[model samples]
Structure formats: structure tokens, C-alpha cells
Target: MSPRIPLIFNSRSWNWAVFAVLSCSLFSGCALLPRPRGLARFPKGTPATKAKLEQVKPGMTVAQVEAIFGSPGHTSKGSSHDNPPFLSWTNEDLTAAIIMFENGRVTQRMNAGGLK
Candidate 1:
């Protein structure tokens, strides 16, 4: 009877040890799981105002263009090859688009989905 009791106790303890190890391994695996990507910083939606589409004539400066159409949605320095350096503007919704000259004039303009 004494020997049987010891055997049973040992079996129970071994089962508990196995359970603990499996639980720890599962929890650690979850920690190693990959995280999802973050959302875009810019707001998302269609352009509320109609896009203005017009030819951008040469010699327009940056400021003058902004005056006619208000401020641009976003602006950045022109690329190395883009001549007559300018900044681009898009509507708040990012649908409408325009480009202004470095001197503050409208060099190019396109409306609703015109520029890709």
C-alpha cells in the first residue's frame, strides 16, 4: 500500500509539471507573434471641394499660386531633375491637386484624379 501511494503521488506531480511547461511555452510563443502595421498618418476621404483643372503656365511663382487657391495640402522640395523648382498641393481629402512655383506662382494645375 505504501509503494502504491508513492507511485500515484509521483504521477500527479509529473502531470502538473508538464502542464506548467506547456502553458509557459504557449505564453512565450504569443509574445513572439508579429505585430500589425500602423495606420497611415494622413486623413482619408474624397475631396470635399471640386478639383480645379487648368494648364500650368511657365513663370508663375510659388506664393501667387497659393493666393489664388489658398494653401496647399502638402508641400515638399522639388526632385533633382524637376526644373523650375516647385511645391505640390493637394486638397484636404488628397483628391484635388496643384503645383506652385518656387517663386509663388501656379506652374501646373490639375483637377480631380487628373494627376496620379
Candidate 2:
């Protein structure tokens, strides 16, 4: 004749393991969440100030332009000697504009977002 033995497992151990994993995951995800860099660094949709825009003029040098408008959105110098340089300013809110210079003076101003 053979004798049979019964086995016992604690369900609380499984519950504890699950709770620990969930707690760790929740805390870790919160720690990993991205934080805002800062206002000075510029974020999306930063408004353009009239004071800054007024400082720009057609014939101003690149350095002068930077002083007035911080830094340009972009700059490009063409390979062809006949081509003039360009400067662009952009609002993070999708407001777009361009100022064109000829012989170091502003010759044209374009605004796509209707800025006067």
C-alpha cells in the first residue's frame, strides 16, 4: 500500500510579488517622466515680442541682428557670389516671417502669419 501527501502553497506570496512589481514600475515610470527644461531656453509657441522685432533693420550686420532678435531661426549664405545672405525668424506657434536684406539694408519684409 502507498500513502499520498498533499501539497500547500501560500497565495499571499504571489500577491506580494505582483504588488511589489507594480509599485516599482509605477515609481520608476514617474521618475523617468520628462520635465520642462525652462522658459529661457525657449519652448514651443513662445510669443514674439514687438520690442525684439523693432530692433531689426535691413542694413544691420549679423551681429547686430543677433543682438536685437536673440538668434535667427536660420541663416544661409549661397555659393554664388551674386546671391545675397538671408535671415529668418519664427514663432514656435507656427508663425513664420522673413526679412530680406540688400547691400546690408532690409529691402523686403514678409509675414505669413499676418504680423504687421
Candidate 3:
């Protein structure tokens, strides 16, 4: 009986094998690739929410609230003029707040509850 032997490859096959290995490596834990860059990210939650919320008072314009908390992440109707029906903001930490407005002023602010 004849014994089986491992098959050998030519130059082309070796190049393809090396290419396949390098290609896969380029994506995973690869030192050869450059680090990805992006805009600086900030947390979404209202830190010192109590203080900030206190700053917001009924009859303060949307702009006034924005000055304290920055622009809201979202709004109920997406209306620039008639907002405060409900303005909601989310933070990177997932801490959120929903401000209720009446007569174009902040009436109340509530923590947009997070996971239990």
C-alpha cells in the first residue's frame, strides 16, 4: 500500500494564501490599519439635572431652556415655533428628560425614566 503525502503549492498559490491571510488580518485586531476617528462624543443625560431644571421656569421661551440644557435631542412635533408641547433630550448615558410646556413656556420637567 502507498502512503499519502501532503500536497505542495506553487508560487501563485502561496501568494494567494498570504493575501487571504493579510486581507482577513486587515479587519481584525490588525496593527497595520489606522485608528478610526470621529467627532467628540458627550454623555446624553442631564448631569446636575436638579440645578438645571430649577433654572427652567414656566413662561421661559424655548431658547431660554436651551440655554440651560443645550438643544433638545428631539421634540414632539418638530416645530420650531410651537415647541414645549413636549421637548425631550437624551444623553449618552441614556439619562433623559422630557420638558412639558404650556403657553410657550416650560411648565414642568420630568426624568424620562431609564431601565429598571
Candidate 4:
């Protein structure tokens, strides 16, 4: 019977192998990571805040409001729903920066949000 040879990795080769595995694991960890709850979409333009919400007064035209808050995420009233296109801008789910209009002017501005 012939003697069998056993494979053994030297210390330097073992270190390189460990380093490669760790590097791959680090990169894969980043890719598999979950996005944060509110930061996923990462809003563009001005973020919805109490100050910005207060700035949006009733009677401001949609154009003026757009100038301030940028495009609305979603509006409660449309042209069909509201002749003047009463606007609503919700930054996140179940929350809204409410801007109301009547008589071709801003009627009410309200902030609606369930999140704390």
C-alpha cells in the first residue's frame, strides 16, 4: 500500500483565505441589510416639518405651495375632486402635510401624521 499525502495550508495562505472570506462577508452584509423604516425612500427637496407645515398657510396658490414644499406626495383633492386642485402632501404612510384651498385661496393648513 502507498502512503497517502495529507493537504495542509501554510500560515500565510490561511490568513489570506480568512481575509478573503471576511471581506466577502462584509460586502454581502451591506447588500442584505434592510433599509430604515422612514429613510427608505429618502425624500427629495424640503422635508416635512412643523415649521414648514406652519409656513404653508391657507389661500396660497398651488404654485406657491409647490414653490415652498415641492411636489406633493399625494393630494386629497384633485381637479375633479376640487375645482382648484386642493392639495395634500403626505411625506410618509398615514401622515400628511394637509393644505386646503377654497375660493381660489388657501383655506386651511393642517398636519396629519400617526407616527411619533
TM-score of each: 0.36, 0.41, 0.46, 0.49
The clash numbers for all candidates, in the given order, read: 9, 4, 4, 3
Q: Give, for candidate 2, the lowest lDDT window spanning 10 residues.
A: 39-48
Task: List candidate 1 stretches off by more than 4 Å.
Answer: 1-57, 79-84, 100-107, 112-116
lDDT of 4 by residue, 57-98 (tens): 766776787788765554446575435635666554435565
TM-score of 2: 0.41
lDDT of 1 by residue, 1-116 (tens): 45534566468568556644653454356446664568432344332234333434566655445554454444444664344454444443334443534444454443433343
Winner by TM-score: 4
lDDT of 4: 0.58
Lowest lDDT 10-mer window, candidate 3? 39-48
User: What does candidate 1 score on TM?
Assistant: 0.36
How would you order the candidates by TM-score, starting with the best? 4, 3, 2, 1
lDDT of 3 by residue, 1-116 (tens): 89977665656568546644543343243334454576323433334255576677777877787788765443333355565475656543334555667777776665543412
Which scores higher on TM-score, 2 or 4? Answer: 4
Model 2, stretches more than 4 Å misplaced? Answer: 1-47, 72-84
Residue 96, candidate 3: Cα error in Å is: 1.1
